[model samples]
Structure formats: C-alpha cells, structure tokens
Target: MLRGQAKGMATLFGQMLPAESSQGAEKAVQWAEVAGRLQSIWTEFQVEQLSKASGEKSHYTDPVKWIATFEAVMRQLPLSNPQVQQGLWDEVIAVLTAVLGQYGMGPRAFEEAKGDPHMPLRDRRFADPEWRSKPIFAVLHQLYLLLSTQVMKHAEAIEDLEPGRKAQLIFAAKTIVDALSPANFPLTNPVALAKANETGGESLIRGFEHMLDDLRKGQLTHTNPAAFKLGENIAVTPGKVVHETDLFQIIQYTPTTDKVLATPLVIFPPWINRFYILDLNAKKSFVRWAVEQGLTVFMVSWKSADASMADLLWDDYIQAQIDAIDHVRERLKVPAVHTIGYCVAGTTLAATLAVLARKGEADKVASATFFTAQVDFEGAGDLKVFVDDQQIETIGQLSPEGYVDGRYLAATFNILRGNDLIWNYVEKNYLKGEEYPAFDLLHWNGDVTNLPARWHRDYLRDLYRDNRLVVADSLSACGVPIDLHRITTPAYVQAGREDHIAPPSSVWKFTHYLSGPQTFLLAGSGHIAGVVNPPSSGKYQYWTNDESPDTLEEFVAGAKEHPGSWWPHWVEWIRALGSDEVSARGKRRPGGRGDKVIEDAPGRYVMTR
Candidate 1:
C-alpha cells in the first residue's frame, strides 16, 4: 500500500514537471496552474487513502465531517439569544463588506493597502512577496483574515458563556481558523508553488515522502533529530552520578574552582521532562555556570515512568526529594543545601519545603529558587483550560501503560502555541520538504519523560483543580499536611513574562503565601528561553524588585530592569546568603574523596527516551 502511494505521488509529480526549454514569467504562471491541479488531485487521493485505512469515512480526511463537527460545536453556543444573533449577524456583515470592498478594489489597491488597518502586516505567513503581489493569493488571504476575525468575535461575543466553555470555544474556533488558512494549501501558498517549480516538482515529491515519514513516527519533525546527541552536543556538562534510586539519580558536578561554597546546591528538575535542559551545552548550561561559580552542584535526574512506576503518588515524589536532600546532607557533612526547581519540580519543591517545615526539617534547605514554577494555580495560564473535571477524569485513559506519555504532554504544550510550534513545522517540514535548524533547546524539548498516572491525578486534583497547596493544613504530602505558609526558607522566585504554562502573575502569588523574605524576578521571554537565559549569551533581560508587592502589577511598577541574563544577579544573591568557603571536592571522585560513583554525568536514567 505504501509503495503504491509513493509511486502514485511520483507519477503526479511527473505531470507537474515543466519542459526545460520553457522559461520566464510564463513558466511561473504555468507552475501555479500545475500546483492548483495537483492540489485537487492530492485532496481526492488523501480522502481515498484515509477512507481505506479507517474502513470508514475519516473525520479529518472528509471536509463534510470537519464542517459538521464545527457546526455542531457552534450550535451549542448561545447563538439563539437575540443579542448574540444580532451581534454575530453584524460581525458577518462587516466581514463580508470588507472582503467584498477589497475584492472590488483589485491588485493595484492591495499594493497600496499594505499599510491598511485590517492588513495582517505582522503575520509571518503572508511575508512572502507573492501574497501581496499576486491578485488571487492576496484576495484569498484577505478573505481568510476577514472571515476568521468574524468567527472569533462571534465566539467571544456569546453572552454569559462560562469562562471554561468560552476558552474552549475560542481555542476550537482558533484551531479551525488556523487549519483552514489559505497559506497551508499548496494551491494558495505562492512559496510552496515556487519551490515546486524551482525543483521541477521534486519538492512536492519529497514533501510527500516527508509526510509519510512523519506519519510513521507519529509526530511532526520540528528539528533535525540527527543533529543532536545526549551528553555530546547537548547535556554535555561534566558530572558523575553519586547515588541512584529506582525513581532518580543524583549527579554531582565536577567543580571548576579551587574553593567551593560550603552549602552544596541540589537541583530538582521536573520529572515530566529530562533534567538536561539546565545543562544543554557549555555556553548555555546553568549547571556548568554554577560549577564555574564554585558551587557544589547536584542534580536529580528522574527515571522515565513506566508501568512499574505508575503507582507512585505525590507523596512518593515529595519523599524522594527529601531523601535526596538527606543523602546530600549526610554525604557532604553539610547542615543545608541550596535548592532550585524548574516548572513542575518547583511546585513539588514548594510542597517539599512545606513538608520539611512541618517535620522540623526546614533547615535542611537553606534557600529555595523557582524557575517559572507556580505554587498557586489561580490565574494559572492557558494550561488551566485542560484542567476542568471532564479532562482530569480522562487522564488515566491517556495511556494504557498507566503513565502519561511524554509526547502527550509535549503535544499539549505545542497546542498552546499551535501556529508556531505545530503548523509552522508542518509547513516547513512536510509541505516544503525543508529541515528545521539544529536548535539544542528544541532538541531537549523533544526528549521528554513520562508521568506516573497516580502522581498526575493527585497533582491535578489537589493542586491545580482544588488550589490546596497555598492554604495551611489543607494539602498533605507523605502523610503530613503541607502548607506554603509554613515555609520560612528565603526564596528567589523567577517567572517568565510570556510563560503560558506558568504565568508570571500566578508565579508572583508566592508572595501571598510564603512566610519568608522573597525576591521576585521576571525574565523577558517564554518558559524555556526565559529560564535558560545564560549570562554568557547576553540575551533577554530580567526585571527585579526587592519589594515583594501584593500584586504582580505593583511588583512590576517598582521593578528595575537589567539589560542581560539574571544568572549573575542570582549567583550574587546566592553568595550574599553567607558564602563560607570549603576546599573544592576532588574532581576525580565526583561525590567526594571516598563517596561511591554510580556513573558519568547525565547518567543512564536521563539518557532514557
């Protein structure tokens, strides 16, 4: 079946090839016509193929089914309400008027209309010169923009719609609008047609091959996967595993200086992903930078969850953190360790600190640092859209292995920024047959870890849905009630200004609960880039305010913006917190002079897919 599909696609490409003797403007028009014909044939072929595979009409392959689903969803909206119906009608009329007016004006008007108010001037998809220069493509683009705008306005205008339903409706409407963009189709996309012409139809042939490969992989290729390797080009920090457990391994890094801080720093990365994000490369590595600052750094590399680990709960993860802290304290003979957590680990770290305070073990962790982690879920960004009761109940059925696959989490995160993360790659990789650049961070993003089903369930219910972690004695971890208010450990909370997973507003809510002195910093980018901004890169800036204001706005009002990475400021803050020096541990022996070493840095556990 696959061979036949490949041959059929090749035969179609053969029909698209231009005679070598033909050249100039005439050839371009001919190629555009060829692309239009291919688009029609491709649609029919796709529908037939999907129908055969499913043994029934496929939802995606059938345009009628897609329209039906969209209509059904829209029908549930309050369109019957007189006010809503009137508002929608007005919006549709306005859209039609704009589109028809533009169509009547024709190509010469579009050239001048580039500066028009309704033009999607900043939108990247229409950046190709042909979209503006060509009449048909320009009109199609304007029509799509006008109609999609009306659909969204209608979705948002639904009177008295519940917030969750409203968000879902807006998202669904957006998904449909984005999917149906004229630029996504070869016939309408001048760039794709030009490439097909330039390659003599070879680009389209390769595009089909790319699509088949992606289908086999069951995910879109965002970056060249062959470009990166763990512990080589990425995650290449020098360290060794000091201890190993069924759940995680502790990696103690090789120090760079003659002396180190007396208090060792242990980092607990989110189990939902590989710990290597902090150690992407020598230049970007937060781990290497800390080691260069003469700090004894240890990282918790979590094991990828499988069916055997599915029974693990919130308490289990919390206990594992405590156990790691204790092991570091006992092995290094230190009274305390500085701790840092990113994303989910940071939330768990807040819980761990509360549990420690409740158990009189708060002194075990001297200082806590959070990177884009939210303890309080109120106003927690778009991720909240997926946390309603219906979705939470279906978490278990997501995987038969009794664990949520890492890919599922990755895809959900991608959906939040679908145009950039999902559709952009689809157009580039499959439609254009182009390989994306070698981005170390994106490569690391693709390497994700599964979540234990029980842990995920408890986390969503107790923290996200119930908002229990903030209230004293309301949430319990490891059989002990944990409260953020009891945590007296000095904290450095860093949030990304553009973070969707953990909104900075929600992150700043730490001020409302923590019974400790806090310094809040806001970085200039989204989740990963914001947190991973290293001093060496001199990239995005970060804002800081010593005054932990009650509101995020007040905090921003009083905040001073710095022009580079926040790492040096954080390192300085770490030093200010009593930086007594100790002789640096021998590098040959990772943990210490006599401590047992499990394996090299990054460890076997983090290397797991």
Candidate 2:
C-alpha cells in the first residue's frame, strides 16, 4: 500500500514536468510502398499462371469457378482469419487467371456471376467449427463462390439504380454478409486475440491471436518508458546540468577497477532505439563483456525527449558525440579515445570522425569500429525502400514537436514480423489469457524512448533519403565540409550475412565509401542473434577480405576460412594496442563532471529498460 502511494506520487510528479521538444525540421508521411512490390507483382503473376494452368478461358472471367475452387481449398486448409482467407483467395484467383488467361475474359465471362462487383461480400458465409477446421485452399474456393455471385448481382443492380446509391447499397450488403462470415480457419480460443472488437472483422480477430503470441514470447511490453532512465550512480549519472549536453555518462566499473586499462572506449549507440540494446544484460551484454576485458568503457544513453527539444536535428547528435568525446577526454586525462558504434549510431561516428579529421584532430580518435552499420547506402537493400516522401510526411505530421516515440519505432519493427510479435500479442493477451515473460530483455524492449523529432527527421532525410553518406556530401556537426576519404583510423566492421535489416552487402559498402585501414568480418546469423551470440553452441561463422572498393562482390571473392565466435577475435585485435605494463589511474574527471563509481554492472540505463 505504501509502495503504491509512492508510485502514484512519482507518476503525478513526472506528469507535471515538461517534456523535450520533438524533431520539427522534417515531414511526417510514412511510406507504404516499402517492400511491397514483391507481393504485388507476385499477386499479378500468379493470377495469370493459375488461369493458364486451369484450362480456363480467363480467371476473372470465371469468377464463380474460381470462387468454387477457393471454397474447396479453404475446406482443406486452416486459415486464421478472413483477411488471410481473403488474401489467399486473391492469390488463388490470380492463379486461375494465370493458368487460364489464354482465353479472353471479355468473351468468356462466367455466366452465373456476370458483371457482379458486390456479389462476393453479399453472399459469403461459413460455420465457426467447420470454418476453423477447413483447409486453406477449400476456403479460397468457397469465398470465390460467394464473392463471384455478389459481384454478379452488384453488376445487375448497377443497371437499375443510380450509380452512388447502388454502390452504397452494395457495400452495405457486402458488410452484412461479411459480418456473418467466420474466419477461414476456426481459432480455438484466440489466445492473444481480442476479446472484444474495436472496429470489427476477422483481421482484428487474427490480430488478437498474433498479439497473444508476441506477449508470451517477450517481444512486446505492457509498461512505460524505463529502458533509458538514469539511476543514482556517478558513473551512470546525467552530466551535472552544467556540461555541454546532458547525455548520461558511465565512467567507472567496479569489476575491473584493479587493472585500469590505458585505452578509453566509449560507445555511441543510435538514438533511434534505446542504448541498453548494446549493453542489454550481464552474460548477454557486449558492453559488459568489454568492461570485463578491462577497457575503460563509457556509453551515451539518450533520454526520451520532451516538448521543448523539437529543433534538435541530426547535427545536434554529431555535436553531442564531439562534446562527449571532449568531455570523456577531459575527464580521463587521455589525449584521445577509441569509439565503437552500431547501426545508425555508427553513421554519426563516421561524421564525427570526419569532422575531427578535417581540423587535423584525427589522431585524437585512436580507433573506430562499426557494427553492422551502413554508411554507403546506394544499394541499401529493401529497408531503404520504405523511406519515401509519404513516410517523411507521416514523420512530419506525427512528430509535430519533433520527437519520435520509441514505441512507434518498435512498432515498425514489429510490423516486419507481425505474425510473430504483433499478432502473437493479440492471440495471447486478449485471446488465450496468457501472460508476458519476466525476462529482462523483453522488459527492456518494452521500456520506451523517443527521439527529438527534428533530429530523427533530418537523419532519415539526409542519410536514408538523400544517401548523403554514400555521396560524400554529408554535412559536418558544425556545418563544415566532410570527406569520407579522410577517415584513416584503424577500423573493424562486424556484420551478419543473414541480417535482414542491415544486409552485409549494404553494410560492407562503408569500406568503399570511407578511406580507412579496414577489415570487414561477416558473421553467420541474423541481425540480433549474430551480435548477442555466445560461443560453440551455434554454427556461427565469419569471413573477411581486406580488399579495395569494398563492394559485396569484392568481399565475396577473397572470402576463405571460417572463424568461430567473433567476440574473441575482436579482443585479440584490440589487445595488441594495450600494454602489458601496469597502467596509470585516470587523472581527469569523467564526462559527467564527476568521479563517482557505479555499483551495478549494466548500471542505470540497463536497469531502466
């Protein structure tokens, strides 16, 4: 009871505080045409093929027969919802056309469903038990039957009534018929699926199923933003309101306090997501691993922005990096330090390196490493396809205050794996009445954060949209010119072959674009798995090629033997720079302007998530 009262008070206090401004120098549109062309083309091609193979005159011409065929298939397959069922029917219908397109649709139209546009929706119906057990293909044919008949009737009605009312009446009829329709497959208990409809439809029901699964699997969280929150530790404290930028800094670790290393390694992670992803937890944390290896590691953890920070642009982040570097150098009494970055954060690092190099301060940056980070995005795989004008518009409209909600960003990721995360949640939480896991990673993932909208918007536009990094016209943190070729820092790039998000092909382009003594290592795992990988358990492998112009093709050519877990290899490479002699203690204060020590391994940020 006491805790609850305190929690409520804390919540109330937090609500009263003002938030940082969102990114405002950008648009708000979300691109819908991303990674959708494949399915779209496939749909068109399949229809033509099916028609040709079925010996039908044309697929669209014989809507009844196709509907019948779909119904037959639905009876055989267990489809989850009407949306899935509808999509299935659409595919089968395309197949019919593809197979039977040799005959002309104009002349060989189905007699029963002639000119009927609304027939399908008006007549479709199915029983719950039987529908759930039905085969996918059988349901398709059944839907085809219902849809064809309705379409035919709608066409007939169109000739008698006015065009506007006729369309409305048809839509109303379709809606009614759709209301009675069961999912192509019967969902035993929706699992995470919705208990009550928000709008309506089988799509919603199926979504519930997916939601359930995601919740149970630790993909989604039910709580508020905690992932990037700071705690009461000097090493994890936000810089005293006096420093340049208030980014939380980590200066010291207790585990390796006895053997302080010479090199200071600070990691700059993307503000697109929370920083804990890199330092997730002990045993699974890369940051923790490095700290154990005796490297003086410091990390910049972004705080969720509020309404007052809308004008913060990408340049602000680069300056933050520079300020962080300056702060760390001042505190550690070191002339320069090693820096590592992941994904978009790496892009910022590259810009920082360029900025520092142009002024002849390149030597201050001892070494640099990019983990699956893309600088040259000429062929940035399909991920870039989504960064269109509309998406920018969406970004503009939604982030009016210039802050991009981390939950919204996470939502986009979940969209890519909708069946596993989003739908699974609906299935479990709302349908099956199951619970989410107590795992830290999932809990952290649920801990939301937001970016200053202007910064994120500029980032997407300049980097993803304009491909500024690839073109070498990237603006520096201080509005000065940047040259990618100026990057002479010893660099190591770690990436995964099967990374759907950052394809090796796209990531390796950094070598071609940047002039640095670089080694590109390709790991054999998906994006998340490859990074968090432990040794000897999985078949993780890597290959490297220090070739020129670092294209995917060039790297593939020089590839040779497979190396085991890359973590050890990285330690060896960086170890060569360290001295075996006893190192001196840090003379300067930390970036946070304090010299206090932290108790926790992952510190406050990890705990926040």
Task: Give Cα-based local distance difference scores for all models.
Answer: 0.79, 0.56
Off by over 4 Å in 1: 1-69, 76-122, 586-593
Q: Candidate 2 residues 98-209, lDDT tens each?
A: 3234223333343222334312222223222222222342344455555545443543344555543343344334433332233221232221112321222223333343
lDDT of 1 by residue, 1-609 (tens): 322333344344445555454553455555455455456655666775675544333332467877986886678656578986687677656655664566468767755765655343236677777675555676678667766776787788876878877777788788788888877766667777667657766666566666766654545667778999887788888878889899999998888888999998999999988888898888988999999898989999999998999789888888999999999898788899999989989999999999999988899999999999998887888887778787777777675678987877887787788898888876676566686689887887777778898889888887888888887898788879987889899999999999988988999887778888788889999899899888878898999877747789998899999998999999998999977998875542385667678788878998776
Please report the candidate that would top TM-score against the real structure: 1
lDDT of 2 at 249: 46
